[model samples]
Target: MTNIGGAFRRNINRIGADNLSLILALVILVFLITVVSGWAGYDGGDKFFSWQNLMNSVAQAIVIVGLLAIGETVVIVAGGLDISVGSVASIGSVVAASVLVGVGTFGSTLLPTGNVVVAVLAGIIAGMVAGAINGFIVTVLRVNPIIATLGTLAAFAGIAFLLAPDGKPIGVVTQPDFTWLARHRLFTDVGIPDLNGSAWTGIPVLTVIFVIVTIIIHILMAYTDFGRAIYAIGGNEVAARLAGISLTRIRIGMYMISGGVAGLAGVLLTARTTSGNPINGVGLELQAITAVFLGGAATTGGKGTIIGTFLAVILVGVLNNGMNLLGFNTFVQRVALGLLLIGAVAISQWRQVREEKVRARALALQS
Candidate 1:
């Protein structure tokens, strides 16, 4: 009992009070939302906790946000930020959809069907190229990350709009094969029946993809040397550089990964909507950053967990779902999200200050 208690204490110490408080808050919020949802019901149907709704929440609302959040987490942990992920995603969607359908905005066929794979590759490459540009601007030109990415944000979005002028949506909406990327299910009508004849269907393919991505990222962040270097650089760039860590290479690579993932997210968005809307990814960057920070990652960087991010995304999804069920307007929802982002950053900074004070006192006592 003593050993187990000691281990528990050590784990808490490792996580720190801020993260512990955040976790508790998440649990409480989830509990309250679930209880209220059950009590209030949804759209006159007593189905707040239904599996169908859960699946929809994960598949439609959460997956893309989660992916973007994961990429943002990487950059944030590496002591940088990319505010242009949304714009990059938008460009990726426009390009990918245009290529996939082999048509330009004016409905002219630009590529053959045999080039579908190449088209997808082209879209991803476009995103990576944008990321590389951001990286070059920041590392080579020594521009601030926030400013560089912000500039790219506008540039990328403008490019997307230019490609699909007047808010046009590209791609064949009625093509089942193209739409299957988002609509396909891992299982259908294969159910586990109880003695009372109750049964459940299954999860969406997108949800599965999201889960796999999360797991892979969790491992990469937790177990890789590259991850450690990122954290080190975030914690203290000079110290990391002295330790032989290549800041330029690492930072550029981080941005590239961020852009690449955002591109893939754009593709997924196109799949889900069956149309590549140039404005599709607008405001997503804010949501992704909000999720990462809310997950207990510091704005100053060097500390965060993939699990925290995953939970944060789930929390956001639930909040959005709950708000929809409560009949709130989209404007109100946006306000709530903006406030949440500010609050998350405030809480994270406060925790860092508190930890610094504690460490100072400890050092003084030792002296």
Candidate 2:
């Protein structure tokens, strides 16, 4: 019994108290939503729990923001923040659409398939360039990350509108191959039927992409020297410098990764909407930032996990879906998200203070 108790304690410690709390919170929220849904008679007398909703609707809806959150996690872990990702994604959307349509200098030179390839590459490169610019401003120009990204946010949004035809959305509905990323599903025939008797559409490609990206990021952060360096830099810049970590290189790389992921999200946005709207991805940066902090990431940096952020993404998605199902308006949803962000930040600060007090007590005892 003693050995079993010791093992359980060790496992709990390994998982972290905050993460366990987050899990509990998630479970409670689901239960409450389910109960409310039952009482309100939403979804035609069915409760909120359903395979279709989880596998299809919620998963698909969260992909874009989820991708952004993954990138934000890396940046935050490196003691940096990026507020320009939404604008960067918009730029990517317009750039990809323009290339696909052979607008301007693209000149209809490539075949349809070639255009698709080029457009995807162009969008991703545009995002990387934007990220590189942010990094340069922060590292070489010595500007603060927040201020630098905020400047680029407005600038990039302008650039996105300019890149579009007459500052309007460009239609790509004619491109069947390009829209596959948004419309197609894997194993369309395999999933369980919904209450409406319609067979599930299988897993969304966008969701699959999000999952793959998350897994890769988790691996990178959990099992690599580069990831350790990022944490060290965030934890203590002076100590990291003494240990020979290249803060500039790591910071820039992180920004680039963030931008690249945003670009991919933009590509999917274009596919999902069947157009390249210059206004696409507006306000998404806030949600991504919210998920990062809500996932138990330290506001002062040096502590976070991809898994935590992913779960937070699911929580946010479910909350939004439930509100929509309950006929709540966008304004109310926004208010709820704002409150959640405040609560998450407050908890983080409280934890930090408590840890400090515990450390002080330990030092005194040692003395």
Candidate 3:
């Protein structure tokens, strides 16, 4: 019995204090934030994590942080870093919104669903194409990732401005296919003789779509050879190249992934907000990157988990929700977040350093 208990303790400790600490910190903060969330009148009525409010918070987190973290994860795992996620997300949304409007003016009853599907697909593809362009400049042209993305970041935003210079929002009239995304799906038992209760609980279809995309990404990263290659290259691009890995292809792939994921986020945002702003995601990049770092992505690259990033998103969502509940000042909120990010990165790095030391010492002693 003692041996078993001791063994379990040893295994737990091996998981380390750093990760454990973050998990605990997040949990404790959740409760505290929940309490504060009530005060924000977040529901426009109550001091509680009402199902609706909680769902809203989750949706928002998935939209904003999801975009940033997804890109950050891809870049970090490819021996690169991207700080232009926000602009990319905004640009994608604007383009999607524009496309939706263009299709809606068709005035055909059958056009709505087809148009939305097409617009979403095109948006995702466009995002990937944009990311690929960034890769071309960074990898093929040998420009710095940060510098390259930053340039595109500005250019993309400028393009968005040009796409809607007058700041007019596109709607069904722009194409005849607008209402379906807002209200098209029907939920009922298959022509049942007498369906009990309204056969459908009304909810946003986009939620299911977003969750599905995240799941697909998680699987791709966790179970594919290409995924492992991503980590290997990110961990050491020179070593990867020497081992016959295609650094160019890997870098390009990561950027493409970043753009594609951002496109999904863009769809969600347009759906939720019912329109796209020319400057909707100005600081989202920083916040998403912070979330990735906070959730324990290695600054040196090649070390990150989708699950960790996802959890980090939830933690951040709770923090924001809690702040509103607590009636905290908006300005002070971001300041506090900044400090937290710096502190979390410092602690995570320290933990990594300690682990390396311990590992080295163990190996040396064995030798």
Worst 10 residues of 3 by lDDT: 103-112
- CA lDDT scores, all candidates in order: 0.80, 0.85, 0.68
Candidate 2 structure quality by residue, lDDT tens digits, 204-252? 8999999999999998888999889889988899999999998889888
User: Model 3, 283: alpha-carbon shift in Å?
Assistant: 1.6
Off by over 4 Å in 2: 37-47, 104-114, 191-198
Worst 10 residues of 2 by lDDT: 104-113
Off by over 4 Å in 3: 2-22, 34-46, 103-114, 165-168, 171-204
Model 1 pairs in collision: none
TM-score of each: 0.89, 0.93, 0.81
Q: How far is candidate 1 from the true structure (C-alpha RMSD, Å)?
A: 3.1
Report lDDT (Cα) of residue 68, candidate 3: 61
Looking at model 1, report the run of 10 residues with the lowest lDDT sum: 192-201
RMSD of each: 3.1, 2.4, 5.7
**Per-residue lDDT of candidate 1, residues 176-232 (tens digit):** 666776888777676654322323546677778788878887887889988888899
Best candidate, TM-score: 2
